[model samples]
Each structure stands twice: as structure tokens, then as C-alpha cells.
Target: MRLPKDPTPIRTIEVVPYDPAWPAQFEAIAAPIRAKLSPLALGVEHVGSTSVPGLTAKPIIDLDVVISSRLQLPEVVSKLTELGYVHEGNLGIPGREAFMWPDGNGRHHLYVCSVNTPNLHYHLLFRDYLRQHPDKALEYGQLKEKLAKQYPGDMDGYSEGKQDLISRLMQEAEALSGFALHQP
Candidate 1:
């Protein structure tokens, strides 16, 4: 649980067409992690673009392994480490801890977040919104495509560029889901 001396480099952003196999890929990755964490993991779910069917994405699965409290985070981090993931503390987002698998396992982003955190809720709400609205998902896919092209080598820029769109979508999603948007 020690931080690396150097930061991980931002790689070029590459968005690919929707792959039907993405869900299965998530299951393959989640199963073992879930088994290892057991009750400490309130739930483990696939979130982000890969979770929605027919949405073009970067092809990296985004997962959230939820816990009941922040107190459990260290244990979760230890468990994930045993599974070969390096804990990469929140990466600027509070209420969630990021983890990266050693090179070559697969392309994925994993996070551990407490139940009911705004960040976690946002992820679920946004994912479900896209799932229920194909047209909106298509719009989102298009946005990602444009952003990826504009910020080809800048991951931060790509993500930053999507903030406005994501915020608007999240507001709509929060209304639909009856969860007040929590801003950090």
C-alpha cells in the first residue's frame, strides 16, 4: 500500500466500436475478485460505456467493487493487491480508490467505493441511464469519438472535455433515478 515514486503516464486514447463480448469480459474479471472479497464487497458491478450494449467505447471495462464503509477500504485494497492489482488512491476523486492490474492482464479500470457515495451513485445512474436510452447512448458514443480525436494523446483533456456533457446527462439521470446529484 505504498505509493509509487513516479506517476503512471497517460497513454493515447483509443476508442473502439462496441464489442458484444464486453459484458462477459467484465464477468471474467469480476468473478475472482468478488470471490476473494466476499461479504466485504457489498456488490461488484460493471459501469461506464462497456456496461451499455452497442455503445462504442475505449474498450476498457470500468468496475466498481462497493463496500459498506470507508473503513473497509484498506482491506479491499489489500485483497486486490493479492489479486495482483496496485492501489492507486482515488486519482483525485474522493470516496473511491482506483486500482490498476499489472501490465498484460487486460485493459480495465477498477475502483473500490463505499456504498451510497456520490461518486458511486453517479456511476450507476449514468450507466443505467445510457442502458435505458439507446438514442442517448449513441449521442454519448459520438461525443466520445469526437473527444478522442481531439485529445488523442491527452487522457486528461479527453476526460475534461466530456465533463459538461456528462454533467448534463447525470442531471437528467439523477432526476429519472430519484437520487439527488452529489457534487464533490
Candidate 2:
């Protein structure tokens, strides 16, 4: 199930070998948000497959900027908007707030969420787990590659299909941190 030869004008997806510069790229992008929303921003982290060293990804850096509460969203969104970010709302994930990163190349996802929420914590736990366990990261990479081929243009399908595998890995992640799931 290879991806279509010709895709839409949006260029919603692309395949690329992991680059060493992704972390720095995330840091560069997170800096301004960190400065402007320091009061609300608890911690900014680099997550997603690209953050791992040897994975193939869509060449997009994914970040999570932790805040204090959902009510703080408007002010944070305003700050991000001032920096040219396009607020995309949840895009389906109810507890998570996603943004369309403004570089025009569709190469980053700047997700905003509060520390009071579990979404960001889960992402961080999973990422950290994969970072500490390279074997798990490899397994996840293979699963992702297979899924991307299976549901090339269907983001929702691809994401949903990977839920089981993700959950299993996340269980391991949570155990590693001794962090039980907190209802969001």
C-alpha cells in the first residue's frame, strides 16, 4: 500500500530519513513561545518519532509546551498567533490542542497543553521510553512504516490503527517512570 504518486497541494505528508538537527530545530522554534508565555509555559519538550535518532519520519518536529490549565489556552494561542502559528484546535484528539506550525513547509507540530492534562505527559513518557529503549523504538518505527504504507492519505485511520501498539508501549513507558495514568 504505497502512497499515491501525486498528492494534494497541501503536502500533508512526506517521508524523510531522520535528521540530526531535529532537536535543535525544535529548540529554535520553542524559544519564542517559551519567552512570551513563560508564566503559562511549564516546560517545552521535543517528542514524536523524529526525536528518536534512527527513525524515518515525515520530517516534522513535534513539540509540547506544557501550561497550567486549559483556561490559559486563549492567551497562549494569542502569543503563538502573534508568532504566526495557525491554531488548528484538537484535529480529533479531544484533550490535546494542536497548531499548524507557520514555516509553510508543514514541518512542525507545536502542540499546546497544560500540565494538568494527561496528553502531554503521555507523549513525553512514550518519547522518553523509546529514547531509553532503542529496541522499543525500532519496533515502533517498523509499525509506523507499515501503517504509513497501509493508510497513506488517511491520517485518522493511520492514527487509530496504531492505538493498540501505542498503548502497549505506553504502558511500558508509564511503568518506567512509575507514573500511573491520571485521568485528564
Candidate 3:
């Protein structure tokens, strides 16, 4: 019989009331990143729970920097590193390279993805769908709140709990957008 590994100790999940200031905070972080990446970035967008207005989230902004090709990743990473973002590889998600700034700048997540990558499209679609459908966004926010309470510091458990809802939403989003949902 296989035993489960001990959960990595992480800060407890904290879902706060939706803050009107989130967009400005996201822009504050995104602008500098976009300026630095420049022509290399086909698009830089805020894509995540915080992007949806009135959605209660964990107060971390998620930004996607879309590039034109995989060959461009090395230069993109080098440029971002010069600006103080530590490249953390793909973090198990292919086509989306993740990065983290040393603590204190802001609480945020960054991903560099190719323009043609399905993950990039999914992020945008999900964000747009939630923005257009406040009812669904509220439902998702409640689910997140419940899961955060249930799992506490267990990030894996919290994410796992949301898989079903995310899948359902993604399918709906894909159907609405006429694009197949692609896993990354």
C-alpha cells in the first residue's frame, strides 16, 4: 500500500472580499512587465479570479505575458530576470512558464505563454466569461471560499476541490467561444 506524502506546509488560504483596488494593483505590476518585455510580448493580460470584478479571491494578481513562439522564451526569461523575476520553469504546466519576484514588490503570479498556446486562450476565455457573467462569478467565489475554509493551508486540496467546477466552467466557456478546451 502506498502512503500519502505529508502535505507541504503553506500559508493558510485567505479569501477576502472583492476589493475595487485589484485592477489598479494588477496594472501597477503589469505595466512595468509589459514595458520591459515590449515587442516580445504579443499580449499581456490580467487573467484570473482577481480579474473578475466582485469576485472574492486570495488577493494575488495573475498576469499572462503572451509571446509569439517558444524560441522566444529564453530571451523573455533573460529580460524578466534582469528586471528581478525569478523564472521557475513551467511549474508542471507546459507552454506556460511561471515566474516570481522576490518578496515585497507585490503578491502576484506571472506566466509567459506562447500566443498560440491553448493555456493562454483558456485563461483569457475564463476571465472574460466570468466578467460577463456575475452570477457565475459569485458562484465560483463562494466555492473558493468554502474550499479555502475546508482545506486551510492545504493548497493542493483547495485546488483539487475546485477541479470539477473549473472543468464545468471551462467547458461552458469553450462552447461559448467556439474553441476546444485544451489542458496544459
Q: Which candidate is the best by TM-score?
A: 3
* TM-score to native of every candidate shown: 0.90, 0.83, 0.91
Every candidate's lDDT: 0.90, 0.81, 0.90
Q: Which stretches of candidate 1 lie over 4 Å from their true place?
A: 1-10
Model 3 error, position 162 (Å)? 0.6
Worst 10 residues of 1 by lDDT: 3-12
| Candidate 1 C-alpha lDDT tens digits along 1-184 | 9888766666789999999999999999999999999989998989999999999899899999999999988888888999999988999998889998988456899999999788898888899999999998999999999999999989889999989988888888888877777654
> Which pairs in model 3 have colliding backbones?
none
lDDT of 3 by residue, 41-127 (tens): 987899899999999899999999999999999999999998999999999998899998867445999999998888998899999
Model 3, stretches more than 4 Å misplaced?
A: 1-8, 182-184
Where is model 2 more than 4 Å wrong at Cα?
A: 1-13, 102-104, 182-184
Q: Which ten residues in a row have the lowest lDDT in candidate 3?
A: 175-184
- What C-alpha root-mean-square deviation, in Å, does candidate 3 show against the real structure? 4.3
**Considering only N, C-alpha and C atoms within 3 Å, which residue pairs clash in candidate 1?**
none
Clashes of 2: 0
